[model samples]
Target: MKFNRSFAVLLVPLCLAFGLFALAQDSDDRARPAIMGSTIFDWTLLPVKVSEKGESRRVLRAPTATLDELECHVTTLNPGQEAHPPHQHPDEELIIVKEGTVESLVNGELKIVGPGSVIFQAANQMHSIRNAGDTPATYHVIKWNSPGMLSLKKAAKKMQK
Candidate 1:
């Protein structure tokens, strides 16, 4: 094959640019933890373990490179079962009901909600959720820490102790 010097010069820069682009993409993926990246979790495939008050499955928990923390899980409570006594924390939490009903007590206000309902509990406000149906109640709980809030992993570990 006959080669041209000008063509070779152009090819060199193209190859270098491609190499640098690929390296940048790989570094971007590595900079963020896998759990902190976008993920799709199938709740049916995850094993359910008994929580302090009911059955639950941890969906995800990871610290992001941006100094934020996320913790999520799905919990199932039997009829009349309470996940925990009324408590308050500094992390904001969101609960999405997937099945049955839940009686939520947020900062002394009570409300009964059903499937597909979303509940937002603000930071440091007393809250509790219990099954308010005849069957088991299932819901997804997603909690995250604000810039000035306490670390979610540390708080969970401390509660376990």
Candidate 2:
């Protein structure tokens, strides 16, 4: 079989592109397996990491069958201490107040709520939480990434680099 020079030139790049795409897909699949079955997280068993602001406990961070990523963590903020500076991200999060009082920055407004209250921080919106009471305020944060959200996040990070 005779191969034209121009045709071969095009075929080489196309093959390379396909190979790269396959590699990328394979890496994504191997990154983390989808979490399955029931699981339990005991509060007392979770190791607490103390910081200047307060304490934190990372519960779970893994991809689920339906979600690209599911992350949960507990935060205990000392009085007048903020979890972090008001910031925004591509993933939405739910904050469930475990105890004490928290002042949450939701869409530029500060809302104060006590234990058992839940706050939803929409994606790409500025949000944060701080201990509003004299004692430490504890809250559980659940964040998730929908399909393709992880790719978008990675692209955004690459742009920032």
RMSD of each: 10.1, 3.0
Residue 12 displacement in candidate 2 (angstroms)? 11
| TM-score, model 1 to reference | 0.68
lDDT of 1 by residue, 1-161 (tens): 79999999999999999999999999976875654666788868888898656799998887655536789999999899999899988788999999999999976888999999999999879999999999899999999865545446577779999
- On the 0 to 100 scale, the lDDT of residue 48 in model 1 is 85
Where model 1 places Cα greater than 4 Å from the true spot, the runs are 1-35, 51-53, 65-67, 151-161
Best by TM-score: 2
- Stretches of candidate 2 off by over 4 Å are 1-27
Query: Worst 10-residue stretch by lDDT in candidate 2?
Result: 29-38
Model 1 collision count: 0
Model 2 TM-score on a 0 to 1 scale? 0.84
